[model samples]
Target: MTTTLEQTAMPEAEADQVRAVLEYYWAKEWTDGLPVVPVTEGYLAEFLAEVDRDPDEVLFSITHLNRHLTVRLAAINAAMAGCRPEYFPVVVAAWEAIAKEPHPARGIWQSTTGTAPFLVVNGPIRGEIGLNSQGNIFGSGFRANATIGRAIRLALINVFGLHPHKLDQATQGTPAKYSACIAENEEQSPWAPLHTEYGFEPTDSVVTAYVIRSVMHIEARHTMDPEQLALDFVDTIRRTGSLIHEYTSALLVLVPEHAEVFAAAGWSKEDLRDFVFEHATRPRSELVAVGKDALSHKTRWRLSSDHPDSMPDTAAASDDPDTVRVLSHRSSIQIMVAGANNAGVSAVVEVFTLNPPREFPFSYSRIERAGH
Candidate 1:
């Protein structure tokens, strides 16, 4: 069956000028509560040529709904998000990453918790496209970071019908739903780039997508010792409201200064992960007190099976719910470096667990230039 946009007439909105076009889309509820750049056949055609991809070429399919997003439609969304043709490839790669079933992004899109995909870029394309890797990387100002991320949200709305109160059921959506993209500060990172850790070549560009619900920024300037620095992160991750017992995944984005602490002591990313996994815990009694018993035994079991050495000290006394250890596995933690150098500031973005019947694993996709 034909699934590409090329086989159908393009949707049109009448307008005489750019302002009219923005107003039209805003009125039609086709935008993310913000004005969108006007799209035209002429502009979209130019964007299509950037990758030389067929308008009908299907990049990915949303398995649950049997929906396909074609290259032409993606370009249209890219243009609508104010992305230039050169930024189209990164957009495609981000979509390809989420489109996979392994990533299970559709669950994230439809959930009431309102999770958004956090895109992290690596390699030459980061510098080439001017993606933000430092100094308010998560904040606004940069065109490439903002628009590249916005393009993905637009594609989700236009192609997948994730419209608010329609397909999207976010109870309290976050501002991140608008746009969230950042590049790795590879030159400043103490360890290899994220993509490299995933086994990609250093020179290759890649986009790693995480379904995140919230961000927690922390400052750890009290001590320069690597272990002490790790304790600070452990404390932050174990916050009472974080639902630690139902742990899914956590991403630690270290600023250059914080990363340098570990690098100077010859600590690898793995060391930090191990440290966080060991120390980032809360009392099981707290979970039961807060009506989280379902997580109590199961999580303890998983922790023992996954990291026996790090298992809670009170496992022999299962009823002693006061025993701490919410984060069950080291694999649930991911590490990377971003933000400006010379500050103890860093952030942790958490990807919460999905409700019953829709667990999707974290995933990554390499960003290959269209011609490459």
Candidate 2:
């Protein structure tokens, strides 16, 4: 009797087929690892309908590939990221911010430094979109938080061409890559939302980009005295161990709990800034070990206003083993935003974007245009 050839099961065959296709494409270096939903006209068109942006409009173009993302391409990335159509504007805005030259997208993504972008949102849309800022905000479970974060990461990967092991040389990237979107928790914040602090109107939506290594919490319950609170900040900064590049910017997020303490003590934003400035100085010697040496020539062993022209200089090739703690001008703190609802605890995250002194006014991005 003629033996019939064994047939592959349909489901098994389908799985194998998909796997084979993925392997072939990836082996040829065609994939970003995460299986991208086919960004077809149909799939992207629906996203466009929600945002109602012009397909030809250039939103943001990231380096080399100079992937100039139009509304349609952003929609494709947004759809694949599982974002609500309304989230499209936020996604585009963030992309534009990171792509702006100083954002260091090329350096941030490609450097062995394990830094990643955090999308901090402000404006009325935060309340409208239900982005999380309360307890467990970083934890999974919030749709707005998840998708807004995903949209930006996908844009970086797809538009900026930061495929892992190729362009993105992160030594050990964090799970934040999946999504790191957080709102100002405006309703809960005692001060203005982040956008307003950054000079946007209360009704305007704005996104700020920062390259953060980790989110560190400075415990505020030690005491309610604002100076004591400022001292707590001093302790954290002195010990932070952030020897990043001179231009790296750190995010100081105030939790509502701690904000209340400062507010009750009648401290203005300038007061906190000045306190952080005074207590945050580090000996330049301690810095040489951690940073890229880009600004060592300019940093002082101990920064002082009276001694602005001269800093305690340490040689880059100095053989003296004990000169590592030179003090430099305390790079000013930046872009403060408050989060949480309880009003007792807050956070200060050391961002990797700022370093060196910048003289020009910094804008988060071209203000988010209302339309495309």
Candidate 3:
């Protein structure tokens, strides 16, 4: 639902009080209102042993804060999110991914664009953690999916002090700020998991987080001409101009049902990317149909003032399509074959951009499940 800001500064307290302290830090406004498991010293110690990072070491530094999230804080939030003791490692890794300096945390943490970051779990760990990658993957009811995502948000608030309407100035916050997570249907996926695409191995577990401004559904029957279906899909997005966001481009998550329509014809994720990049593009003139003054410059983005006339209307909005690239950067379009038992159509996970991706101490990582 809605997460408000946590209570004002809490002074130092005894060891036993830490749990109550975090809960208070979480409850007054830090949380999405779900009950949280307390993060105790013992829990933090256990996570540290696994990750083996210096407690004071800067695992990540937020550009928006004077504070840096310690391994202890990440662990505490992970614990609060009901992560298994072993899951702390994964939590830490996800933090590293989002905290990457260029990952775009600063501007996104406080943007009027009203977007929220979503964590996607890929690789073999999906089944180990019991994530729902197959049916209703994006829906609620999965422990790992829910908690891992929430753990990061908690870290953002408790660690970086980004609360609603204060530093995080969104007119209408999204559900992802509460909990947004999902796993890849690796068993059913035809291509390499996203982690592998980003450099991790198939055997390795990885977490990837991106700012998704909004999500939309792609409704189409399994047509004989999948390319034709794709054209319609592009047209669908073009009409709304969501792809032409003043801030960034939109994300399109393709489900298995829809993927197979292309697969039957042997169309790979790359094929989809190529097809989309080739056919789903708009001219600069067309992209700025709403005009250029729509977007504001973000500090997190490494943009050049070189193009004063890329589009008649884009001078002030944005110039670097690379930062906001949608269909081109194989990294931009994450294709996950998931959703529902029976379906001719699939839901697209359109993760709207935050800025450029942040690169800091942390990167996508996963926990080693107990006994695994």
Candidate 4:
């Protein structure tokens, strides 16, 4: 059996009456504290037609709240977020990524730390839909980038009831919470596109979603030496507050300038990830100084209780703070290219750091084409 929302059409109101509709919805607290396009029956139907999917098909379920997300409701929220009908597929893919098992973003939406699911689009759809992967890629300007991300946020708010101060209790919410989506600059990338790296063909579209706690921007123009550049990035990771202490996902968005340096010197994406993972370290004493007890830190990394391997022989004997690995594993570091091809600038989108990662692990969903 299919589930469909009852046809709720707005009354025939002239342009002047638009304000009343907006005000009524706002007063009802149905918005994200922002103006939204009214989702009438006609508009919702138009969006659903683009996907040709069963409107009642359950995409994912918020079991705690007894809420099952359906395509029709997604279309309604997409329309309210001002998305074109064609954008619905990408929205569905993003939501599916977040709902994937072992990485479901159940608690992330309401965490005390301000975290938001940032979407990264790959493949032909990015160019087909005019998703920005160039200059100002992470900034505002592109309609597809803004509204597509906003559509997901709208679904969380209107459909799943993730309202602020209630389901979403972020203490100091970030501006990125509104919409943080961008496409990878595959054309400018020195290596393969993200989808290709994930084993998808070049033509297949893909979307990845992760709950980013914060971002760290890096500028590597001071020196062209590869070792020096890697040191700069490794130090940044070492100093940054990682949500998880070990073997977790961290995204590095390398710009053309930084990527070119590695490409010219014969360094692949794996090379970069490995180098950073090896160098991103601190002494066990450093963790102790930060109030992370040595015993817990060892357990966090799964080190042997009797023979901890994180600390160097000298550091362990002397209680020095210069011999522990900060980043957990090499495979957890993901690399992508974006931004203008000019300066040595980059950004790191960090994931949450739970000792025992319960929710919000890195997730990816392939974007399905209509009629495929």
Instruction: Assess each prediction's global lDDT (C-alpha) against the native.
Output: 0.78, 0.62, 0.63, 0.76
Identify the runs in model 4 with alpha carbons over 4 angstroms from their true place: 1-15, 101-105, 243-248, 295-322, 357-361
lDDT at 77, model 1: 89
Task: Give the top-scoring candidate (TM-score).
Answer: 4
Runs in model 2 lying further than 4 Å from the true structure:
1-40, 246-248, 284-331, 335-339, 359-372
Q: Residue 75 CA error for candidate 1 (Å)? A: 0.8
Return the lDDT, model 4, position 234: 76
> In model 1, which regions exceed 4 Å deviation?
1-16, 101-106, 296-324, 354-361
Cα error, candidate 3, residue 165 (Å): 1.9
lDDT of the structure predicted as candidate 3: 0.63
Specify the poorest-scoring 10-residue window by lDDT in model 2.
Answer: 321-330
lDDT (Cα, tens digit) per residue for candidate 2, span 138-172: 67888888887877677667766777887888888
Q: What is the lDDT of residue 164 in candidate 1?
A: 87
TM-score-sorted candidate list, best first: 4, 1, 3, 2
Tens digit per residue, CA lDDT, model 3, 12-60: 5664476677678556665656767765687767766767666676667
The collision pairs in model 1 are 285-321
* Local distance difference test, candidate 1: 0.78
In candidate 1, position 255 carries an lDDT of 97
Indicate which candidate wins on lDDT.
Answer: 1
Q: Quote the positional error of residue 288 for candidate 3 in Å.
A: 6.8
- Candidates in descending lDDT order: 1, 4, 3, 2
